[model samples]
Target chain A: MRSFLSSRWGKLAIGVVLVGFAAMLPLLNIHIPGVLPGPTYTPGALSVLAYAMLIAALALSYHLIFGVAGMLSFGHAMFFAAGAYGLGILLNLLAPSGMPPEAVFLVAIVLTLVVALVLGNLVGALALRVTGISFAMVTLAFAQAANVMIRRNTGDLTGGEEGVRLEASLVPEALVGVVNTRNLYWLALGILVLVYLACVWIERSRLGHVVAAARENELRVTVLGLRPYTVRLFVFGAAAVLAAVAGIGFMLLQSSATPRISTADFTLTLLVIVVLGGVGYRWGAIVGGIVYTILDQRLAELASSSWIAELPPVLHIPLSEPLFILGMLFVLVVMFAPGGIVGISHRLTKGRGGKKDAAEPAVLQDLEA
Target chain B: MSTVLLLLITGVGLGALYFLVASGLSLIYGLMGVLNFAHGSFLTLSGFLGWEVGRRVGDGTWLGLVVGMLVGLVAGALVAAITELVFIRRLYNRHIEQVLVTVGLGLASVALFEGIWGSDPIQISVPGWLRETTEILGSHIPNDRWLLIGAAVVVLALIVLFLQRTSYGLVIRAGVENRTMVTALGIDVRRAFTIVFAIGGAAAGLGGVLASVYFGTVSAHQGTSLLIYAFIVTVIGGLGSLSGAAIASVLVAVIQQFANYYWGIGDLAIVLALAVVVLVRPTGLMGKVKH
Candidate 1:
């Protein structure tokens, strides 16, 4: 048992079990139906699932910078928004008629990747010079600049204050065949799983170790002859690509993109999700994503009910009440559950083995100390 | 040329309002390192209070302003107390937690405000004496705009006196510079924080009244939107520097007005200008660089 627990294959097996359970979640929902009966099987449910998946991807990408890389980026939404708009513009130009829509989608994804890389490089180069809060503010400046540029040049392509819409050319044929909503959901879920696995793989690799080490102590990493800036730039670019991919996925789900999508609200939402899920934990992102999605959807549903509608106009709040609730959740999490769901889970599990390891020195003691 | 003059005057007037809002934010941050994201919402709340008072007692603009300021004082103290007891007290040295908690508070305040007031913008007309436009450099500028500028100057003088001329203000400044030393000297740091917060709140309330009169309307969501501009001013002026905030507010107002005239893009141009300033000067116009 001890040997199995220590082995990498054992960990891989556990991961496989987790993924298998996730894959069968829809089946499980069917078995226990009508518990929360608002379109769990329909195309609408699939669309919501797709959105949740996209949020998961975005949250995971945020974790890469904030969790693994130890850089708090207050403006990562800019890159995501930029990628979506880039794709929107590309699909508009291509206008795939009778040709496979996947081809156009792929083209858009590639374009978004390129854009993300360039943005990541430029911003990383400038921001890496400073650390901590300044880094966050610099990134915010970039995002604000992107938002302004898009809003100002509205006549050219952004659809101005009205926002840009997705033409029919971007929707794939495969998506059309199996309920476009289902296909989108599956696509987003598949991408999310793939990205999560990629992140886990990276976390176990030599590059991940270097990055983790750099985050722990940049000066120490520098003394060890590692170029912290190069490592940061690469990780930043990779994370940007993940965020961009999520953006494309969001476009697929929403069928449109607006400058408002990159606003402070979205940024804060992502931050809350990350923090609520436990900042640096891997599985925490997925857990956080699911919780946030459920909470958001439920609150939105409640806010739009007939009873709410019947209330006097003075007392009735708008769709943003969900955001308010989410914000409150964030504050509570920061105050009481700093470790987040995953962190709390770890603590609980670790408690079981406490007596056995009580006498032993802590792992990562040098770093923690 | 007349258009330019109009834009400039309007910009200056708007800048005066920005100064009022940003000064409160600056003082709060300066004293306690608490980046009160809810500052703008406090302004909105004060406006609501003023509007309610104006509606109740007709032709009482000055009275409304006074009521707003008093309400602001109470609101600020209450919020600061709650936050200190509930959140800020725990995260005294933790900057990230401080930011997150304040942001959450800001969001909750918006929700509460919206729940009470709904989404529609509320119009608040100034009294007759303040409504008429006076000729200024061949242009008809509203007396309300002049009043805003004058009020900002007066507030600035009062704040300066309070901070520089009074013992309590000296203690507050000393706390900002060295909290540990002040605590060591047997001063109640928490009490000092409460006073600073109340003062900041009052300033925001005053700004909110000006905003209601100038815009001729108030909305529950105004705080969130206006927050972006105030944040820009705070950043460009240098975080935690009142003088820097004052200067940055004027700069932002003038630039924003010019952008509105030339660029014709409502909020985008000003946002871009602010971004440019941050890029050029990360520490702000007068912010001390941390080495």
Candidate 2:
């Protein structure tokens, strides 16, 4: 049984089952109190689920850069904004150019991907010049610049602080409106699966090994005639492009893109999600994304609940703030729970064997090098 | 020509604000190698409390403003020192974890601030003199610009004096150069870390008060927005050098002001400048570390 579970066919079968189960969730009447607002089949729950999946996909891409490449980037949200805004603007711009709605949708996706690709390369090429903290800082500067540009609404492109909405005329019919929430949910799921598979393929490839090695020790990789810079740049760009893909899904699911998506705080929240889930594990990101979304939503509800409203100021204030709770949870996780949720689970289920695999992400310390 | 004069002085005034925040960042990163994301929270908290105390003391009076500045300074130092002692000290030698802790603190503190003060920017009352304009070279510059510049100059002088004159400053300078060597000398370096945190926090706090005066409002997110520019300045100035920060602050702010005035690309210009600097000299203009 153990061998079967580890076999390629077995793993593929498990993945199929998991995806099938998730896909059927919106069609079922299952309820998870405190986590879901209503039954699973409801539009509200489906919307939340879809949002979580997109976030998970984004976090997975971040894992490729941070977990796999050991790059501490505080600016990953720019590419996300790029994907979201890119699609939003492209759809609105092209909708009036005598293109059919279907054609416009297809063309807009392609253009947004293209824009994201170019942006990823441009940012990677420049930011890759410096290593470690400087790299992080440079990326941050670029993201901040992008944020300012969006907020300024120059030429009336970004809609300033108001942000741009998804052009309803341009999007496909099946992906629009509350009644079609399940379609959007499936789209987000597809994106998550696609991003996850891409991340797996990259990790299992020779380039991934090289990138991982460079993370471990750059000098050793350099001694092997490998250009760690090029490899890292490729990973960074790929991650950025993937983040953009998630952004597109995000735009579709929400039916609008906001300036808030472009902010540094958004990127920090992504960081929080990744760390909360687990640093190096792929499933961790997915789980972290879903869990964080649910907690965030539910906590907001809980804050406004009647019983909690009666609490004293000290208890009431901290409990009422979702981000404060999440942030404190994150700090505690970093300090005590090194491997995050995945690590804890591994330790609980597998005992001695899991202990070795569950060690704290050594990449965290190596970031200084 | 008058426009040029106005932009130049205004740029310097803005640069002074940037320097106030960047100076401590430089010192802390130089000595401790930790990028304190919570530094912005310190500024935000101090800004709120400073305004609170200032209003209660004498609202719109110079006396209130002075008291507010003092409260900001103490609040900053105390909060920073406590953070170092409680959270950062526990994660010694773990740079990434230290940073993550700060990130978490930054997020939590901002939320807490919002909880306390609400999310909106509170209009602050300042002395009437601050609202007036001074004519310099036929250019009308806001009176607050002089206050900002003067306060920043005094801060820079005091920090320089402290670094050069005090024994702790001597240790801090040496520690920045080679922390291991200082540790090998049997000196207690953790104390230095706390001191640096306090000093950095104090500067940021002072900046928070001045920032309220400049913007005429205090908001939970004000520190965060300004923190980004300060981060830019800190990087351009070469992470650990005081003089580098001072020079880069003025240079970046002036360039930003000019670009904003001429082409409306101030933030982009600053970003481009950072990119150019990193490409040309990755260590920064006066950066000591070879990154």
By DockQ, who's the top model here?
A: 2
**lDDT (10s digit) by residue, model 2, range B1-291:** 999999999999999999989998888888888888998999999999999999999999999999999999999999999999999999888878888999999999999998888999999999999999998889999999999999999999999998999999999999999999999999999899999999989999999999999999999999898888988888898988889999999999999999989998999999999999998988888899532
DockQ for candidate 2, please give it. 0.76
CAPRI quality band, candidate 1: acceptable
TM-score, per-candidate, Cα-based: 0.88, 0.98
Q: Would candidate 2 be rated incorrect, acceptable, medium or high by CAPRI criteria?
A: medium
Which numbered prediction scores highest in TM-score against the true structure? 2
Q: Lowest-scoring 10 consecutive residues by lDDT in candidate 1 chain A?
A: A360-369
Clashing residue pairs in candidate 1 are none
Residue A273 displacement (Å), model 1:
0.6
Cα error, candidate 2, residue B194 (Å): 0.6
Q: What does each candidate score in C-alpha RMSD? A: 4.2, 1.4
Q: A273, model 2: CA deviation in Å? A: 0.8
Relative to the unseen true structure, what is the C-alpha lDDT of residue B30 in candidate 2, on a scale of 0 to 100?
A: 89
Which residue runs of candidate 1 sit more than 4 Å off their true CA positions?
A: A1-7, A24-40, A96-103, A149-153, A205-215, A218-230, A304-320, A354-369, B59-62, B180-188, B265-280, B289-291
